[model samples]
Target: MRVRLSPAALLTIFGNCVKIKSVNSIFDFFSWLAMAILLITAIPQIVLNYKRGSTEGASWLTFGMLFFGMTVLAIRSWFVTTDIIILLNYNLGAVIVLIANMQFVYYRIKK
Candidate 1:
């Protein structure tokens, strides 16, 4: 059976619609879209690493830089505003980077 995804479902999962005050509705939608895309940018590489049971194709340096960058952005977002979408973007990016980093460690140790 094929499952259908509604726009509401996508917004519910990726967009903090309720929490975000509407400044311009179009801009707000695009902002959430951009944020969601940025947040998941690392997922493909992470999944690839996991499936391969190795991080050979991934770079520790890149993940380290991403973790550092995301941490800084999350910290800045925490201090600057309480916008849920912004907060989620940076914070979730950090978590994703950390998970990738952990995979690096795990696979390295296993070798």
Candidate 2:
């Protein structure tokens, strides 16, 4: 016996596929924009730390926690295919935290 698929069934499947793609596209765009914002916000702090050669009032505990947290977040994002935004933000944040922490530690030791 041969089986036939109805037009409504075919249309429903296609419609669902389009919806999923649309949602994914929207998520990707928003995630990309969020990552850009994170980068922009972090760059100034990173630059200031480099230029000043100090972490001054910034707490070591704070930066250390942030560095570790971001590192873990980045790794988690890597495991989830849909988390590119998180991956970018956390990885870049980790780098910035590491740089700042290093500067802080160096100045503290120097003094």
Tens-digit lDDT track of model 1 for 1-111: 999999989888666655454545666577568557755677888889989999997889988998898789889989988989778877887898999999999999999
Question: What is each predicted model's overall lDDT from 0 to 1?
Answer: 0.82, 0.74
The C-alpha TM-scores of every prediction are 0.64, 0.62
Tell me model 2's lDDT, rounded to 2 decimals. 0.74
Q: Give residue 82's lDDT in candidate 2 (0 to 100).
A: 67
- Per-residue CA lDDT of model 2 for 1-111, tens digit only, reads 998889999999999999999998897687568557656755676677667877665667876887787778677778875655566666777777678678777888877
In model 2, the runs with Cα more than 4 Å from the true position are 1-3, 57-73, 82-111
Residue 42, model 1, lDDT: 75
State how far residue 62 of model 2 sits from its true place (Å).
7.7
